[model samples]
Target: MAVQSLQAAPVPVTAAGRRRDREAMIAFWLFMSPMLLGLIVFTFVPIVWGFLLSFSRAQNTVSVGDFIGFQNYVDVLRDREFRRSLITILVFTAFIVPLTYAASLGLAMLVNGVNWGRGIFRTAFFIPTAISYVVASLIWRMSLFNGIPSGVANIAIYEWFGIENPINWIAGTDPPWYWLVLVTVRLWLQVGFYMIIFIAGLQEIPRSLYEAAWVDGARSGWTTFRDITLPMLRNTTIAVMLLLFINAFQAFDEFFNVLGGTAATQGNRGLARPPLVYLYQVAFQDADYGRGSAGAFILTAIIITVTVVQGRLFGFGRSA
Candidate 1:
């Protein structure tokens, strides 16, 4: 009886089960078809085409047969405007990334500490992130800092502070108040998003750890935060910093709109322009697809390098 039980027969495949499995696979493929099709057409095709086009001298059109080895790359690198744009982005990223990280972490801690209305606070802060950059830029430029005495910012400055002259926030280069506008708008849009991320990270921390720390004579505020909270949040901090750096590098819409769109190209073209805007002028406006494509790859290489270096610095993929 023991031997017979040990050699029990295997269950047979049921016809209904087989049919259901096949139907499920078919449904999955059917559901995924649109996304797969779109990815291939929009993303994969462009990436491959742009790569090939970058190696060619395909000016005025992307029909790619001219085949210039590395001249396009050399030209892009040598162009002074392109170099200036790189510096502009570097500065912008330097300023925004740290500010965003600090603000996000601070807001996250504040929201996490609250005993009530947490959802409302989270929603209020995060709603700005959903707003279009162009729309926000318009609001900042037209309504808030319109360079007129009647503008909200100008009114505050003139009425409250007793300043005789209204500051031309965007157009003026003397003080470069434009950076203030750029940084503030970007900060307002992004801080909430990162705050939510930090909040999630904060929640993941075990309450037992904090209780233990408290019993061990760790103070409730800065001492506990510095020793326990920050160390516990290392992974989340690394992720947030990585994302912040990427977003800062991709800054374009705000700079373009707030700086005056095509009018930006008219005077002081070198001021406040980032790589994307410069690449746009090259590829779309100037019809130099080859150089534009090369410039894009160059920027991609820079971003990849920075991300890798950052990951290494933070021990991102390392085991604890």
Candidate 2:
């Protein structure tokens, strides 16, 4: 009888197994209920709504309006100001990304060397990042580079070389001066963040690699960096570049607060106005919601495209 029982076919328990799976699934859903609900209510819903609104001519006061089809996109693309804004944003990103990356790398290398007071130096470097962009903008506009003799720049210039005229750093009509000022401010505000990233990357690198390089008669700093440091920091460099590019594209508070607008400056274009600021003026000041939404979508597309291109160029996200 025991042999017969052993040889007997197993009783069908597929239904029981199915029931157990159902119960597990129910429990999982219950556990994930809150997050799922939040995603539906906050993220998915808003994205769907915004996408819908992009096709419609909705005023800021009201949520719904007449469907406008491709008119908004057509208008934005046709507008000269929008084109100019896009160019301006591209230029800003181009200038700031390289400058920020270079400065951050330099600062990271410097701070990574110092054994004494390294913590203090690191904290000081990163303190500006802790401040809000608006606060930093205001401080720079009023105190540091205030385009006056009493400003810090002026004081430095005077103290160092006894220069008579304090240069108006922010009030230049030419592209070069404006570009310089914009890059300087952006570098000052952002270098610390990238420096921290680079520092973290630097720390992750194995000391053994450096020792091995030294053992191989790599005495030059440049050789060590090229062979040891750069290869190890490839990922960090890509990350910093991506972030810097995005931030440069979205720059608004500094440009808006520091230079005001072309209207306020009496047709004096302040170096350049980025796409976000241009969209703001179009949407709020000019009451052109459709065009603004179109411009925003285009800007988003540009950012995505540029990021993808950069990733491809640098081979980011590949197995290191």
Candidate 3:
């Protein structure tokens, strides 16, 4: 009998502790109620309404008419403008997402390594995120890429480099130089926001991993980055890419303002009219609300389908 003694099991939580937790949970939900209410009322309600309206034969989006089944969806599917708009968005996304991802990551790496004035650099980069698409487009259109020979871009290429002809950036469709104007402004506006996100992700990675790699005779910086840093940033990269995809799909303000000019004097929208712009024209301008709503749902489906496929491929929610 070698001092056979039974060890006590783990102590149960006190009633007071349980009560405190319950109270804390109540307080949390109480605080969250307002935000939840707002989301339901403003966002969810409108979404549900829009879905319903898509199936209806509504002339103006607000006033609902008789239900027309899937006719509206069928019409929008057959519409050439809608199909073209989808292709334009795909083209835009192909250009913008990769450029933004590379730019932001490079910027983040640079900012992270800076020995001094890091805050200043971060602030300077992030400042552009606060600028509205409307304002940025105006600056690009009215000053930078105004298409005139005296414009900033024209002056840079023609005067500084002594090029014979100033390129008509906006109006020129042959070379598709207008893409430069759109892409540049979007990059300037959004890169800072994504860069900050990358910086946060970079900071979250453990310094010990680099030290361990170094101890294991990994002398090359690029090797350490490839093996440790990139692998560690899987989640952040997935999130950033997903957001980039969604935002790219939602692009409208800059396109409309820069290309079309003012509301009173709309430009040639036939060139690069995205789905949102097409929907806007259909809904508000043309008052074909049912078709517009159908287009909206179609676009939503495309976004959702892409997101689901990507999430699956990336193993977004799975354990590492």
Candidate 4:
């Protein structure tokens, strides 16, 4: 009887221990309830719904509709306009990412070199980042590249270079050149944001490394940059590249505002039309919800794939 009692005593204790752990877990879950609820409502719910919607024919007004299997995706694949838009988006990303990185790195270097008013310089560079995409697009359209003699670019061209006529930088369909204008405006708008990122990355880098490089007699700019700055900035560089690529691919506002939605300008000739814009046209303008949803999903897939590829190629988050 004594042995039986002792053996039975541990069972109750173990049961009590398990109950205590269960209660603690319940409390922890309660603590996290609000955040979990918010994530479900805002993020997870939307993502799941969007994915489901991609397979259906639901419009913005209608919540649910007939399931169309792979018809939506098939239509998108066969769509020439959608294909063109995808290519345009890719081209835009290709141009903007490298340009943004180079410009941001240069701006960061410039700010870092300054002995006084570094804050002011940093703020000035970041001011554009504070502006919304719509506001910035409007500003660029009206004030900077307005395409008239009174416009900034035109005025500068006429006064400084003595060119008679102001060129319509955004209106022309000339292959590479119109693309250049779009890319330049995008670069001007985006460089500041990336500059801030680069500045932060640069600041985090230890001064000891540079001191060591100096001690090693690495006085040349190329050698020091290649050996010290580039290696140290690898993670930051990957982040900047990813951000620039995503922003470039998802670009819509500037293109939409600058290149208004006339059918003539909808094709490859127009600078403003990216995949998102085309998707917007199909979903909103034409009311082809199924096709639009498919395009959106395809675009999302492309972004995910490209980001993964970039991560693999650049080894992001793998090292310090």
Candidate 5:
């Protein structure tokens, strides 16, 4: 038989089809317009304006005063307090990242293994993520660790551990007991969110892999988890670590609420102050918009650099 020529016919676009296409496009843009408008007005414009302000002498006012040419950056970098704040954030990140990572992962494992009431356990663990950092900070400050004899922690310590002294948890910078308050509140607020992410990752891991490991005599719990669970969750782990690092670096709210003092009292007291808090004091309190903007950019640069380095180390984009 002769091979038939298989010429494909082009479908004609009718006026109705074209009209529908055009209407769909219009509707799509209409739905997207609000978000686009907000992004341009709130995010893009501020970033551009802040960048320009960083290079200017815009003290006490956002109006671009003069083209200072890195004067603001130089001043911000040379500020001793600012350097100390950077160190403080670095320490905080170091402690919080690993602690949060481990806690989240462990909680995820425990929740994943639950044979009953999984939703209840998951919800119970995750509810803390909904609590506001400011509110949690207040709870931690006023009720949990208020340092008063009647406070929860103080009472518990006194009753159980027989510690007579009511430890001034937040104010005692000499021993830096304040870190406990900061770390615990942040940990409580953050772990649940990351734990949920970890649980999702764990669920995605195939049961067949675990079964196969058991067959191979990797029956030991730690061995199976080490060889199977961890490797399977590499990408998820990296993502969680990156988020934890960035969040730790950007910590401000709890620090501010717990430690911030009135202008009359000046209660920052040179302890546990993160870079954001320092920038807030510089920009808002001291009215040094130029330097504040500069410091903000500097912190942004540092974050980007660290993220890049971490992604590289973790092989983030590679298949796990």
Candidate 6:
């Protein structure tokens, strides 16, 4: 009998290999440099500068004078408009997040179940996401939700249903009718994107689990989905919710385009103006850079805090 001894051979690195590796690293970095540079220049620098401006007294946003040290923040926090705008955003987020989430999840489920033309349906739904917010808002305002009886919404309510008057969907704040417009536009523009995310998450779930459930007489689709699909999609759901919350908070273009008009009077501005709209008026209209910057930071903090709380509650990235 013979015993064999095994020796591990080391991987050989030639001089040419080392040179190629170095060159590859250099080339990779070269490819990345433009994007890295753009991020630093456009995103990072603006964020840092905005933070600094928040603490300073800048009238025109250009000449930063005297570090007033939180005066701007205090002023912004105490401002009625700022407080009101933030509150409005909170209310909007409360509604839009849930509605969008449910709608997207339902749409994803429907799209996932389709045996044919899945891509066509997904692309059809996702087409709205590509539409510019301004254009969508304009279409919603001018064509769909227009105050006149000729508008689609008014026609449905007033003509088809035989209501006496055409309700002003955006302008009427008596029952907060404007919320209907806001919520609908947001759902139309965003649900498709989130639906795609949900679809991706749904696809990752194994078919074997569903089959096993079916074998166990969990043949009811709703039962299987509730017991299996939702639980499996927990992290994905959390991510979608977080993103929805952020998007809701950052709502500006639609609100601005719909509500903000040529007349910049306080009377013209309605109740649904979000924080960004308020900040926009402050910075651009009133030329209050310091306050605007403070408002920006305050909104950012609110977004981060909400996200962290949600992540904690949902046990995101945590094992079962």
Worst 10 residues of 5 by lDDT: 1-10
Q: Rank the candidates by TM-score, best first.
A: 5, 6, 1, 3, 4, 2
lDDT of 5 by residue, 1-320 (tens): 23445664454699987997799999999999999999999999999999999999997789985989999999989999999999999999988999999999999999999899999999999999999998999999899989889999999999999999898998887788899999999999989999999999999999999888778878858888898889999999999999999999999998888885556645654787799989998999999998999999999999999999999999999886
Tell me model 3's lDDT, rounded to 2 decimals: 0.90
Poorest lDDT segment (10 consecutive residues) of candidate 1: 262-271
**CA displacement after TM-score superposition, residue 94 of candidate 6 (Å):** 1.1
Q: Which of the two candidates, 1 or 5, achieves a greater TM-score against the reference?
A: 5
TM-score of every candidate relative to the true structure: 0.92, 0.84, 0.89, 0.84, 0.94, 0.92
**Top model by lDDT, which number?**
1
Residue lDDT tens for model 2, 172-265: 5543455665667768888898899999999999999989878888884999899889999999998888888888888887787666544655
Q: Give candidate 3 regions above 4 Å deviation.
A: 1-30, 261-264
User: lDDT scores for all predictions?
Assistant: 0.92, 0.80, 0.90, 0.80, 0.91, 0.87
lDDT of 3 at 97: 99
Scanning candidate 2 in windows of ten residues, the lowest lDDT window is 261-270
Worst ten in a row by lDDT for model 4 = 261-270
* Model 5 vs truth, CA RMSD: 4.2
Off by over 4 Å in 4: 1-34, 59-65, 175-177, 261-272
So what's the TM-score on candidate 6?
0.92
Tens-place lDDT per residue, model 6, 165-280, is 88888777788787888889989998999999999999999999999998998985789889999999988998898888888999998888777555554553657889998998
lDDT of each residue in 100-218, candidate 3, tens digit only = 99999999999999999999999999999999999999999889998788899999998678986878888789898889999999999999999999999999999998888889999
Error of 2 at 240 (Å): 1.4
TM-score of model 2 (CA atoms): 0.84
